[model samples]
Target: MLDIQSLRRDLAGVAERLASRGFMLDKAEFSRLEIERKLLQTHTQTLQAQRNSSSKQIGAAKARGEDVSAIMAEIAGLGDALTAAETALQALQTELDALLMGIPNLPHESVAVGLSEDDNREISRVGLPRVFDFPVRDHVDLGEKFGLDFETASKIAGARFSLLRGDLARLHRALAQFMLDTHIVNHAYTEVYVPYLVNAESMRGTGQLPKFEDDLFHVPRKDMEKLYLIPTAEVPLTNIVREQIVPREQLPLKFVAHTPCFRSEAGAYGRDTRGMIRQHQFDKVELVQLVEPKDSYATLEALTAHAEAILQALQLPYRKMALCTRDLGFSAAKTYDLEVWLPAQNTYREISSCSNFEAFQTRRMLARFRGENGKPELLHSVNGSGLAVGRTLVAILENHQQADGSVVIPEVLRPYMGGLSALRPATD
Candidate 1:
């Protein structure tokens, strides 16, 4: 949520920034609502003062032993008017809140001013895409020879699902474990276990609700409250401090979680439909940091590097790109996407997105820290897919495939895969 004070002070400036991101702010509507809210609040305050003054008058009349019936009747009439004014004021406030909640976060000044992914600036590329001696196969074809079973997965759960067996399944699990261990040990992030199903308030705190409902999977309970499936572990990990006020000593809180993520893919139709690249369900090792505002930008760089470290450890070729203003996520002030090379596609695909949300998420979550001045202030949030497990799996399969339909496991993941070095096909 934007600071209402900023909007009140300069709605035009805020709206203009929003326009750069292709979001048209309803200026006329906002102005109208603001005017009405101010009027209603003023009217309510006046009525409240009037009611208090009338009660005092009635008290004096009773104290003087004079007939107080007339005064009592006047106070009753004032009570009715005050109640109506207060109710109207409350309703208008709710409307204003809803409007504010839907607005995306303003991009940071450093973000490039552009309208799409094409305008995103490349920061740097690490490791070159290997030249394959044989015709490259995508993850699907490479995994099928070993353990990737799509037909069975589809039969059980419909499209955009896959079942891996033997080494392939172990490799997938190993990827997640490797990421979690690296983040916890090397990155100084506390590993947490969170619920996969969260309440609507949790979703709202993380900027996932009231806008992207269609893209979420929700369960309606008998009590009528809906629990939403997490689209990423970032939601749960970052929200750990929701509605909390941390002591200054805990200025920087980093957390990591390895969890299964589910997305409805409501808007993603017919894209990457052939492989695990766009699965409905996938595993991820998420990284989240809550830091004092002063340290947030530096933390974002460190956080992005931590994710890049995973790709480097796996020896995967990847590049970092700074997302343009319009290409930034709804809650992010700035974002960096790490696109890993895919040998089959002969191009890079996004494996992780690191973002500095500034105080956008903290404002909504009411997550704050007491500062040196003894006042509570919002904490800035940073998070990223330390590496999307499925996509990393895809990168490994496609980039490490051998001519005999075998996939060589990365050296770091071998420890988690029972010291096995590669995945090979089974002979009948």
Candidate 2:
């Protein structure tokens, strides 16, 4: 939500900025509505004043034992007129607010204005893709050697699902635990356990509702209201402080949570339908930061680096891309996607996304902080996947495959795997 004063003062400039994100702001309608709002507001105030003065006159007439019927009739008519004006003012204000709610966040000046992901600029690269001497096998092939059974998973669930067995399943669990431990212990983030199911307001606070409703999985129980399977811990964790005014000392609140994310994949019927790359459910350790407005931009960069730390520690090759205006989401002023290299695909794939929502979400949630003068002001919100556990597992299997169809565990994950050095094929 933008400051209404900013919208009123710089309507033209604000409209143009929103246009870059494909939002059609009706300035003409907004201007007309603004005019109506002012006129109705003034009329209501004037009528209220008239009613107050008339009430005083009626009281004096009653005390003097004079004829009060004429004055009483005038008061009754003024009450009706005042009530109508107040109703009209409320309607106009509601219309104006609806228009504003549909508008996208204004892009930061540093964000490049472009139409699609092709326009995104690459910022940095880490590690290097490993060279294999033999015909390389993808994760699906390597994983099957150690009991990754898609057939069994499909039987239990449906498509876009997999069942890991033996050491493979343990590796998957270890990966999530390791990621959570790293984010909490080393990254200076408070470990949080958030609800995997959230209410509609939580979704709306993070700008996931009203526009992306079809992309979510909603579960409605008979006795309780509908709840959405959280697409990411970011939604639940960040909304914890929604509509709150935190003390200035807690300006930079860093939180990390691990949760199973569910996405409907409604429009993506046939894309990445292979393996675990695009699953109905996946584990991700999300990082969320609510900080002072002035510190958000720098915090975004630092948060991205923290995500890169996990990939670096695992020795994964990856690159960062700066999302252009068209590539940015409705809530993000700017975004960066970190794509990790998968040896099987022979290319990089998105494993994490980081974004700074520069007061866009804070305003909607009424999330604020006390300033030096003890006045409330909107805080900035940012969140990202430190790393998606499923994709990370895929990258490790494909990149660290051994000649004998075994998987060499990354040194960082060795402890988590109970000192296991390699994942060997079980003689079932």
Task: Give the C-alpha miss distance for residue 29 in model 2, angstroms.
Answer: 2.7
lDDT, model 2:
0.90
Per-residue CA lDDT of model 2 for 107-226, tens digit only, reads 899999898888999999888888888889999989988888889999999998878888888898888888888888888999999999999999888988867899999999999989
Local distance difference test values of all predictions, in order: 0.92, 0.90
Candidate 2 stretches greater than 4 Å from native: 45-71
lDDT tens readout by residue for model 1, 276-338:
999889999999999999999999999999999999999999999999998999999999999
- Model 2 scores a TM of 0.92
- What value does the lDDT take at residue 139 in candidate 1? 87
Error (Å) of candidate 2 at residue 46 is 4.3
For model 2 the local lDDT of residue 381 reads: 96
Alpha-carbon shift of residue 108 in model 2 (angstroms):
1.2
For model 1, the superposed segments whose C-alpha errors exceed 4 Å read 52-70
